[model samples]
Target chain A: MKASLTLGKVTNFLGLGFFITLKDLFTGKLEKEEFKNFLRKTIVPLVSILLFIGLWHLGAKSLYNIEAKFKIEKALQDQGQVAADALKTCMVSGESSCQPNTLPSPSQVWNSFQSLLRDHNIISADKAAFIEKTAAMNEKRVAAGKAAIVYTGRPSFVDQVFTSLQTVFAGFLLALLIAVPLGIFIGLSPNLKSAFNWFIQIFKPVSPVVWYLLVFMIVKTLLIGSTEDSSFTISFISVGLCSMWATLVNTAMGVSTVDKDYINVAKVLKLGTFQKIFKVVLPSSLPLIFTGLKITLSVAWMVLIAIELLAQSPGLGLFVWEEFQNGANDSNAKIIVAMFAIGIIGFLLDRLMLMIQNWVSFDKTDAI
Target chain B: MAYLELNNICKTYGQSDGETEVLSNINLKIEEGEFVAIVGFTGSGKTTLVNLINGLIKPTSGTVLFKGEPVDGTSHERGVIFQNYSLLPWLTVGQNVFMAVKEAFPKKNKKELHEIVANYVEMVSLTPAINKRPNELSGGMRQRVAVARALAMKPEMIIMDEPLGALDALTRGNLQDEILNIWGKDKRTALLITNDVDEGIYMADRIIPLRPGPNATLGPEFKIDLERPRDKTEMNDNPNFKKTRNEIIEYLMDIGNERKSEAKEEYILPDLVPKDFVNQFKFGR
Candidate 1:
């Protein structure tokens, strides 16, 4: 019995529980009924992903043909049959210059992804070489009463990704700091909750762009004499303001809804105010607080893109916006890549919060 | 003077039109080192009575005096064992006990507190499950942990508000005996609020009935008048035990029947019909 339990634990540890079920079936350790379930679980999602890609490829091809036909007609009207025929020939030859501007195919996106990585590498190398060559001059300048010359090289795609992560984390921390204590105080008092209810309701649904503009107005004035950029600060502050409402509301709800029985126990113990909140109320309300925090994180990530774009911050949002306006053949592909990056990062953040929640919560049921 | 006294206690919620007078004119007194049980049926405001005594909630009208002084807020001197076994789910049994012991005896050092916690945990035979969280333990085991935590405090008075009500009969009997054995050793001023007549007779020196509410108050008290280390098997045939038990059950049934009869109201359905059916009835019938 213990051996099987250990085997089950190891299977889950490696995240191969599903695969092991199939293995068990093949080895006659599982029933035919379970094998059918295994097939349904594994094969259905794979087939669905393939079907989605197939549909996307078909749509892209149709849109490409329409664009090509329109170009050919425009060339015919403006430059005659000979020119249109030449244009058609150029298109038929599959020249990148004459490529139709439309939704890119899966292969085009894959190629664009590779190109971005390669570009990042080249830029990284150039920055390193520039830093090394300028080291002595920068040192001499610093030794003197003058500022050292800094690298003005363009940031790579990976650099922008890192910048975005830093901004979001800053925003997430800021939101947590502001929301939790305020929420606890509000939750502890009914009058305070009533007073703040309008404030939360008014600001919660405001657009991220508007929040960015507000932060920009405040931060730009605050940093008027400072040489450092305020765009990052403004973007992150906006992201925090935009995303903090969910956590604030959730924390309040969690705190207010703590079990009355637990409060009685606190009373019976004659715990001081701090002990009552920390030992009894907080522990009881932690699950709901985590639920709120998860929502806040997702909101932070979602609001960050628009805020970054508005604030002109160096991040994924700006990268996607710049690519969109550049309108190169590969620019659309790059935006798609950014979209995937945003989704994966948001998913990872949610998983991270869940891990922390599970660690703190004594309840042993698997977190959703 | 009595160790604890409730003078003309009344507890009410809301004001004016929304007023709910849950308990009214409740008066009781218990001397120190005496075991007293307040017996009642479900929803007889027994918890409200307990809360009044423990200072969780205050009486709307009267005052509760403990040791010749007016009761204010909760204190370490009066420890409560709640009906729901209000053990903190995050803490293990040992930690739960440690928290109570720390609060009850603030001067004790860490080693002394640990010793107190360990002793109580052992007393309840929960040392095996000492490291297990409240959620991991069975209902009976969790109640035992609560019992350990309350005892670890070593309060002058231990108030139990139907602590074993949720357990199965056998488990309830086991916890009752376990609690009795501990109480026998100390003879603290203990107040038990329970619905069980057998439990009251078995545990308390005196049993008082909390008459059923909308305005519940204490009924007449029954003196157990039995020898210590009261055996359950022997109580079944003890003429005095049988007589007290019968009297309590009969009084409870009488009040229950009276409450039922009093609560039976005349039914008057609204003089209305569905719009569609009304038209049909008016046109055809």
Candidate 2:
């Protein structure tokens, strides 16, 4: 039985791979040279980094004057000074850190990033030791009673990315659950629709900031009032509310515009209410509903980031804010990386939704 | 007793200034298994008369009786074939016919129902296009589907409101023969409303003419004592057919001429001139 199961699995995998390859070939997406170029570009950088580390291990790995290059050290020191000043001002006065901030240079930030990656056992034990040794030397200047300034203590970029992604998905799913059915109901009955129309119109155009503030206050009052929890709840609520509106409006419109003839046929056939809605009405309105959902998803993404910025939630928006405050340190380089990551992730999310939409779409022409 | 009766039926629309009377005191009786045709010019209340029979519209002052019971509204007992072929466009031809058959015989199993519907579709010669939608087929084929649907219902009376009027002449002739053949078999009571004199003469046992109307009434009934299984080529050679056709044509022509004269006078504008201006012009002359 086990052997047969293994054989079945292998066959299934081969079949899937064959079809995927065939599809790529048919669509003219299988450019071997381009794929090879991508592999070369990606591998070359990592290989170069490994070779650099090896070369350092062989030549002047120990007793190297880590800070003797004052030209580079001076530039790094100036950046760190600016970052410390900005952090002091923001923490002391509750001021924004976005005002005319100085940022660290690429090489300086790259050195710091390498050192942190090497020591954070949070990532690996050898890297954590390196980070701890660097931090022990650096923490002599940090004031007492403040948070510990351990160089090895920084959170992993991957962990931050995963945390943000999880929150976005959770909020998006909640919005979908609330919006789709509500939209269908609104679309079906004109009177019920009209009754709610004014309220939605008024609320839909309001800024995410307003929703964020409202949620913040409510959650603060009713739930555990820690800043992190409050911020997360507010950001989630803002995205949900804003995204929910688009879905609701679109769903209703799609349902309302479903062909009248189909409804008449349903009536003539004496289809039960459930059958009429699920089989006839829902299927016919799917295209419009999906269009609405796609728009809502995009809107929700933007709203989630904006709300996070306002609420100081632990996501990409919060990361951007923290980097802005730590203006001239390696944080600047981290911010740029975060921006790229956010953009790429947003695009992938939209493509994922589009794939789902196409899968569920009832277009007759799509039949095999 | 007549299988269907329209006794002194009058249908009017709107109030005094906007009043439009469609039918006026129309009296008619159709015996069981008899085929009758009502012929009229366009807008002459033929459709209204048919609607009255099918209970699509109620008479203002009179009653329509199907087997001596007043027709309150639409019913399964009276099958109607609309002029525009109102088949559910999404459903296939076989499905459209099957829908009616199912409604008429709800207790029948799926296999039996399918066979019955298929048989009727075969009778209409629409077996090939049974799976096609109305839009997919030609107008003539769509009407054939409509015929199949009505016939499958096996109603006591079938009412057709210009079912073949939209078809080409050749197709019309073909369907007319097909309808007559079907009528001959079951001898179900059938009433057809048409504008074609030859069609009425060819297919109906009796032809009734509805006069032109603000309030149209039945003008006369001509008994078509011709033998069944009518051949159009042979119909012209029959002396009685020729006489009856001519008589009906002449009656229609007379009515048309009278209508033209009345229309002309009603449209003629009276000249408006000042009396003093006319007197001054005469004096100057």
Most accurate candidate by DockQ? 1
Off by over 4 Å in 2: A1-368, B12-19, B44-48, B212-214, B264-285
| Candidate 1: tens digits of C-alpha lDDT, residues A99-193 | 88999988888888899999999999999999999999999999997998888889999999999999999999999999988889889999999
The TM-scores of chain A alone, one per candidate, are 0.90, 0.62
Q: How well does model 2 score by local distance difference test? A: 0.76
Q: What is the lDDT of residue B198 in candidate 2?
A: 94
Give the least accurate 10-residue stretch of model 2 chain B, judged by summed lDDT: B261-270
Please compute the TM-score of chain B alone for each predicted structure, in the order given.
0.92, 0.91
Tell me each candidate's i-RMS in Å.
0.9, 5.0
lDDT of each: 0.89, 0.76
Question: What residue pairs are clashing in model 2?
Answer: A118-A127, A119-A127, A119-A128, A119-A131, A120-A127
lDDT of 1 by residue, B93-168 (tens): 8989999999988898999999999999999999999998998889999999988888888889999999989999
For residues A128-186, write the lDDT of model 2, one tens digit per residue: 67666668655754545455545434456665567677667777777788888988888
